[model samples]
Target: MTSDTAATAATPAAAKSPRALARARRRHSAVRFWRAYRTHKAGLIGLGTLVVIALAALFAPLLVGADAQSVTDAPGEAMRAPTGEFPLGTDQFGRDLLALLVWGARISLTVGLLAAFLSVAIGTVVGITAGHFRGWYATVIMRVTDWFLVMPTLVLAIALASVMDRSLWTIVVAIGVTTWPTTARLVRAQTLAVESRPYIERAQALGGGHGHIMTRHVLPNVMPLVLAQTTLVISSAILTEATLAFLGLGDPTVVSWGGLLQDAREAGAVSAGDWWYLAPPGIAIAVVALAFTLCGRAVESVLNPRLGVTR
Candidate 1:
């Protein structure tokens, strides 16, 4: 009896070892998204670059060891290329370009993230509402979205920004508002497809509430579209915000990459041979946007597969 009991215990332990090993293998598989993320190599590189940029942006203050608003007391002058201390060089005002660039990253990422999220959130709600509920409700929601689709995004954003007193929030909101139409249209299409599935029909037969059916079944089906759209929107929002900031439509109080461009342009840094003043911010915006575009496109192609794009 004792021997049989010990054998049973040993059998259970032996069985668990393979299960643990399988679980680890499963986890390892999930991390290799790049292996299947082909069809957009540039996008992958861009995505990777953005990740690095975001990390640096997040850690900028610690890296600089200085407050963003605090000016250096040193009698520093501007238009110089990179030195050991200020790798990116100083602007006309003698503020450390490295520090300002790092600080500016915070603004760029903040606008990118916050504006993207707001755009996604608003678009999702409008899309779902229009798709799941037909008749005049859908017509009204879609007609509003049409205005967004037709209007020139930058011009509309400028007009909106002009009214809001030029704060960071104004930039964020303007970007969010203009960018939502695409997401809404995508969501509405997805919802239309999902609402017709047999499972949804069964749920309706069972007297499930509209909220429950939408939340549980319809929403999950549309989520992939939402996630993929987020990457593209983040980069787009950042670029738009930067454009507004550069144009003097942005809040004058805030320091953004666009604001830097505006300063550099106003100072004639390019004509006067201050390439350092103009290069970093432009490159940063381009790199970040390219990264998102690549990564988003790659993931979308992989998931949808029928797009037939080559690796």
Candidate 2:
């Protein structure tokens, strides 16, 4: 009995607790994901670009003082050509264009990330619910989703922004609520595919409730799709915010890429032949959008190998 007890005690902790095993699986999955992600050159480039841009935005205060935005504390003469004193030159307000660009990145990226998160959260919930349930409930949810999907997202966002207060959060909400329909549709399709799997059926047969089935079985499977979609959504959100700002709906108190363009237009940069004022913001927007697109495509390709054939 003593020997048997000793042998039993020597056994390796019953193959680790469920929590430890889950953590190990997660670590393994992360390794695999990184291995696949790094192989895509475009994705790596995009990620590096974003990292640099994000770091700059995060450290904007240290790079340039807040006085850079102050008209009274202008750093250089207005509309001066690029030189050693001001690489990007000064805007009509005599604020440093370089400083504006740096600060603008902070606002643009914040709006993009927050708006995308809100959009994804709403879409994921609505989609999973609609896909999991049946009968009139599912029909109603899908009809609502279809209605939003059919309407022009930009128009809806414009209308919402028009009616609401002009602030950063207002823009975030306007973009988020209007943009969710696409994500909802994508997630619903993915959810339906996941629900059709044998494991889901087994889960249901084993007395798993709706919450259990959806959260445990369905959500994990669809998360990769959500992640990829989120990156794409962020690009769209940034573009939308820029559009609204350019249309004179942005908060006047803040500096954003879109606001810079608006200021240039109002300041007659075009008539004055000031390309520096127009080019920097435009190029920044395009580059950031392209970076997000590349990253999204890479993630999508990694998750669905069939799509990577062309790449």
The runs of at least 3 residues in candidate 1 whose Cα sits more than 4 Å from the true structure, single-residue gaps closed, are 1-35, 38-44, 72-75
| Model 2's TM-score against the true structure | 0.94
Model 2 poorest ten-residue lDDT run: 302-311
lDDT of 1 by residue, 89-187 (tens): 888877777778877888988988899999999999999989999899999999999999998988988888988877888888988888899999999
* lDDT agreement of model 1 with the native: 0.84
- Candidate 1 — which pairs collide? 39-311, 43-294, 46-291, 47-291
How well does model 2 score by local distance difference test? 0.91
Query: Model 2, range 1-311, lDDT digits (tens) per residue?
Result: 99999888867667588999899899999999999999999999999999999999999989987677788889788888888878999899788899999999999999989999999999999888888896788899889988998999989999999999999999999999988988888988999999999999999899999999999999999899999999999999999999999998989999999999999999999999999999999899998999999999999999989885334
Among these predictions, the greatest lDDT belongs to 2
Which residue pairs in candidate 2 have backbone atoms (N, alpha carbon, C) closer than 3 angstroms, thus clashing? none
Clashes of each: 4, 0
